[model samples]
Target: MQRSTPRLTRILACAAVPVMLVLAGCSSDSGSDAGKGSGSSSSASQDQQGGQKPATVAPAKYTKLPNPCKSVSTKTIEKLVPATKSKAGTSGKSSDITSRGSCSWNGLDDNGVKGSQYRWFDVSFLRYDSETSLGVSGQKRAENNYAKEISKAQATDGAKNVKTSPAKGVGEAGTAIRYELKKTGEDFSYATIVTRTDNVVITLTYNGTGYAGAKSPDSADLMESAVAAAKEAVASVGVANS
Candidate 1:
């Protein structure tokens, strides 16, 4: 009986070994499949993210703008504003000169008994950059703002006898606006020239009034001066970028 018991015990142990081996094999297969599934999910996430890309737009023609104070020639400034207070011009406040800039000259020429002539000239520049995220080209932006400038000039408060006409040979496109206004109990005449050259827009304003007995400046003369100054300002943009 004792010899038969030993043989039975050894047989049971051998049978248990096979069951343990089967359990280990099942565990190994499950682990491998789970790893493969995780790998596939990660690869798919990366592929989806990589598919999204930013849209492209046309590049801007002008990257930088010329200095507003130096954009015009001394001869032009002297002719426009005689006895000017500052020949170098007074620069307007600008946080970003590359994007926007302005310069102005003003003078009151006292003629003693003949009264005084007050003249003022202002020139401003605006440059646009291509926006890839918004998908807007610089030239398109300039064109849109050019229209807005015209509207703004026409809507001046207290302006009378306002007129608009094409400004020939100034830029790619140009407009001349003339108007009259009453201020400080005096009659004033004004002329504004708005021109767009590529991605940059130039606006020139010339205004004058007679103090005492002097005659108010003519609208036609102001428009001519504004147009000529605008042409020079537009040319400076090309020189700056070059």
Candidate 2:
């Protein structure tokens, strides 16, 4: 009976060894899976911290601007402003011609005793760049400025009978403002066109006043000329960018 009891204990101990080994194996596998999951999480966190995502912004359409002085053709200038002092157009002072530029033409056409006709024409251009921090696209910035230009022209102090209308087919969008102002003892008819093409804005102003006995210029005619010149100016932007 003592020998039989010893044999039973040995068998029981042998059975416990396999059960303990199975439990240990399961624990090891569970620990390995946990370690793998932690490593994957750490790798994902590192990727996020290392600039894995980048900010995006809309690209600018027009990177450059055309020369303001030569934007309008000679024939157009000659027809608009007779006997222009500077046939090449007088360029305005601009620290950076690439981003902003302006040109002006003014002259008086004398007709002896019939008095003289005075004419003035000017155009300006502004270009914008895309800014990510501002979260504004180049085209959007130009659109805002285009409205501001129209407002500026309409808000001219001492201007009388100011009228604003949309100018179609000139560019992506445009506005024309016509007003009459008495300056230098003469009534001047003014026409201003503000337009935007992609990332650039163009403002063209045409104003004239009859001197002495000459008749004042017609607003419709002045606006027509201004629109034509504005179309030319807007087209120049495409050419410059191309």
Candidate 3:
């Protein structure tokens, strides 16, 4: 009877060991499944927390544009164009185009070729005061109106790859508009329009410069330089009477 009891006890112990191991393995599997499910839920919650679409990153060059109007001067402008054309204002205004010291390269119309060398420049000065209040922010309203008009003109004129950027207003002056136009035949143009108001005097300048890329390589810089110089010339035109 003793020998039978010992053999029976050993058999029972061996069977109970496998049952415990099986239970442990089942528990571990259940825990692992729960952990995986929690991980999935957490990921979904995180995704929901970010409610909007991903933001697009623009190029640094486009985002950070250099002030192309830096260090502009009338003397430097005159150097670019040795010839100056004089025109008098017929409206009995003291602010004639040339009298205002707007110097330019003459006969630009007759220079180079029609589409190759038609680089031209012009500057205008308009005065505004309390009597000419168009908007609360100096000439902001006028500048805005002019920008809109230019946009419309560009659209109607079938200009391609058009980019318009404006700078912040300085003092009581409004803002400046810098634009780039690329034509179908690789023709390019650069322009700027600005309104500066100092004390009661307001000066506005508009310059359109074009270069024949076919005649030279990448004339955008030349056009930019010319327009900036023109702006300087226009700004030099103060109140006619003052």
lDDT of 1 by residue, 87-195 (tens): 9999999999999999999999999999999999999999999887898999989999999998999999999999999999999999999999999999999999999
- Candidate 2, superposed: residue stretches over 4 Å from native: 1-55
32-57 per-residue lDDT for model 2 (tens digits): 78688889999989988984455677
Best by lDDT: 1
TM-score of 1: 0.78
True lDDT of residue 37, candidate 2: 83
Could you give the candidate ranking by lDDT, starting with the highest?
Answer: 1, 2, 3
- What TM-scores do the predictions have? 0.78, 0.80, 0.39
User: What's model 2's overall lDDT?
Assistant: 0.91
For model 2 the local lDDT of residue 41 reads 96
Candidates 1 and 2 compared by TM-score, better number: 2
| Poorest 10 consecutive residues by lDDT, candidate 1 | 21-30
Best-fitting candidate, scored by TM-score: 2
With a 3 Å backbone cut-off (N, CA, C), the pairs that clash in candidate 1 are none
